[model samples]
Target: MDPVVLAAGSALVSAMATDGWQQTRAAVVEWWRRRRPDRADGVGSDLEAVRAQVLAAREQGDEDTEQALAGAWRLRLQQLINEDPALADELRRLLDEHVDPALSDGEQPQHRPIIMKAEARDNSRVYQAGRDQHITGS
Candidate 1:
């Protein structure tokens, strides 16, 4: 075989391989999208549970404790989102509503935030105190 032709063939093969890889990646993403829950519509348990826990803590007259817990919870959730990029977008959408509610409007609930999960409701979102954006799911 001519050296020039061989080299050209090798380059063509390499380009084909790169294109195939790109297609595979796009397919995987499309599949994941089909599996992904609606960020705006899907209700998560992680945030709901966190909200309940914070509310309970506050009701127990532990305002400081509640704040600490909420902060830790948010950090952990953010971390989990980092681990699973899809979850981050969902979490962000869900929390966007309450991130800074208009408390002065008297419409904001006095209770804490609710932790929600993208999939299972039984699993709780756990936060590690003193750690920023570090989370573990139950």
Candidate 2:
């Protein structure tokens, strides 16, 4: 998948979970209106339906369902980009201008880097993770 499509899909799902979702949803539908006027209404309705599902999934702590919803939107976006290619720019703009801002308004996760150093006389072991990691030692 295109990086922009991936980012936009994730942002779209994240925005749907925010209080600013209505505005973000409107922008998305309007973008679809310009690109595929005939399908705009259906697209809007589908977005709303998906948003409802996402909300319910979050309430139930169903990460799998939320991720599945994101994947669906990613596929939809991938199809759009495959058809027009130029829509990739529009998706990036939507993510940068609207979706990302809405997500920022909500609680943003904090990430911190990890640094580790280890030394031993007989042996040495070191484990480091800048992000998520798993390690086993013997």
Candidate 3:
């Protein structure tokens, strides 16, 4: 499978689980709008249906179902790209510009970030913790 198709498919399903999914949905439909204009409307409707399934799966704690949905989309995108290899670039652009941002917004949680960096030389040890660290028998 094309990496771009994999990424776009993953992003498409991930975005469907987010509040900003409508934006990604629009971007996807628009992709069809440009190349397969006749299918654009149906694509949008299909995405909506997928979104509903995703939400329900999430609510039911059905990770497998969600993953299955992602897989289905991956195949769909691969088919699209198969028909027009040129679409790979466009799909990459859409994932970067539209889908990723929507994922970030939708997955935001009420938690602070934890950053840790370590550089060890000459058998030196570096330890960092965001919350707590306990070392014994050093």
Q: For residues 1-138, write the lDDT of model 1, one tens digit per residue.
A: 222222222222222223233343233234335445453122233334444665566468765755565455445444544566665444333323423221233322233434544543566644443325744564
Model 2, residue pairs in steric clash: none
| TM-score, per-candidate, Cα-based | 0.31, 0.76, 0.74
Cα RMSD for predicted model 3: 5.8
Candidate 2: tens digits of C-alpha lDDT, residues 1-138: 988887778778878889899999999999899999999999999999999999999999998998899899999999999999998888777777777878864433232124666666656655666669787667
Worst 10 residues of 3 by lDDT: 105-114
Lowest summed lDDT over 10 consecutive residues: which window, candidate 2? 105-114
lDDT of 1: 0.38
Candidate rank order under lDDT: 2, 3, 1
lDDT of 1 at 24: 30
Misplaced by over 4 Å in model 3 are 105-138
lDDT score for candidate 3 against the true structure: 0.82
In terms of TM-score, the best-performing candidate is 2
Q: Give the Å shift of residue 90 in candidate 2.
A: 1.3
